[model samples]
Target: MTDASIPSDGKWIPQAMSVKYLAKAKTALRAVASGEKVDWDTSGEKTVPVEVFDEDGQRVFTAEITMNVKLN
Candidate 1:
């Protein structure tokens, strides 16, 4: 699972996301910012759980992103 942490009032800077999932990540991030349910699908055989933590160390956002290969 890929994870990240963000401080309160901080913005998300895209890392290695490609064009396809980058857009989806932005949308999901927006929904998470608004406290709405995230509707995302990995659409791949493997799942990568992306977690975002608040400055207070609380979990804020979570989504199972897609990955090409499975991790051991």
Candidate 2:
């Protein structure tokens, strides 16, 4: 995975990407459902950091993903 950062000028600056496991899926899921207020302006969409690892326990990549939840 390629890592990059954007400045106020709005440009794609590429950087080196690294990975480290912060928590397991269960832990992350619990945190997401921790009863935080939704931001309507974003339509309940949230970005979370995730890490991918290989079967041999090797780190693959890390990235942020957007999750959308629909409420009844």
Candidate 3:
């Protein structure tokens, strides 16, 4: 079972993401990111978890993003 959950806080938020890896992954996923060959774990899909923290060192929010691998 996939136990994926996101927090509901107003503090934590997303600022930016790694466009380089994303663009590379989109262009030639197997050749650029994972390696020359296709890796199962990173072959088709991926899930990215983002954590938001406050100045007091507490978890405020959580965000998850699913990346679809496009092999061309």
TM-score-better candidate, 1 vs 2: 2
Provide TM-scores for the models: 0.32, 0.34, 0.37
lDDT of 1: 0.34
The digit string of per-residue lDDT tens for model 3 on 1-72 reads 012222222122233444222211212112112222323233334445555444544444454544444332
Tens digits of per-residue lDDT for model 1, 1-72 = 122222233333223332223222222232232212322222223333455554455555556543343222
What clash count does candidate 1 reach?
Answer: 0
Question: Which one is best on lDDT?
Answer: 2
Candidate 2 residue pairs in clash (backbone atoms < 3 Å): none
How would you encode candidate 2's per-residue C-alpha lDDT over 1-72 as one tens digit per residue?
A: 111121233322223333455544432222112123323233344444555555556445566554453332
Distance from true position, residue 71, model 2, in Å? Answer: 0.7
Whole-model lDDT per candidate: 0.34, 0.37, 0.34
RMSD of each: 13.5, 12.8, 17.9
Query: Considering summed lDDT, which 10 consecutive residues are worst modelled in model 1?
Result: 35-44
Model 3 alpha-carbon drift over 4 Å, by segment? 1-41
| Residue 28 accuracy (lDDT) in model 2 | 20
- Clash count of each predicted structure: 0, 0, 0
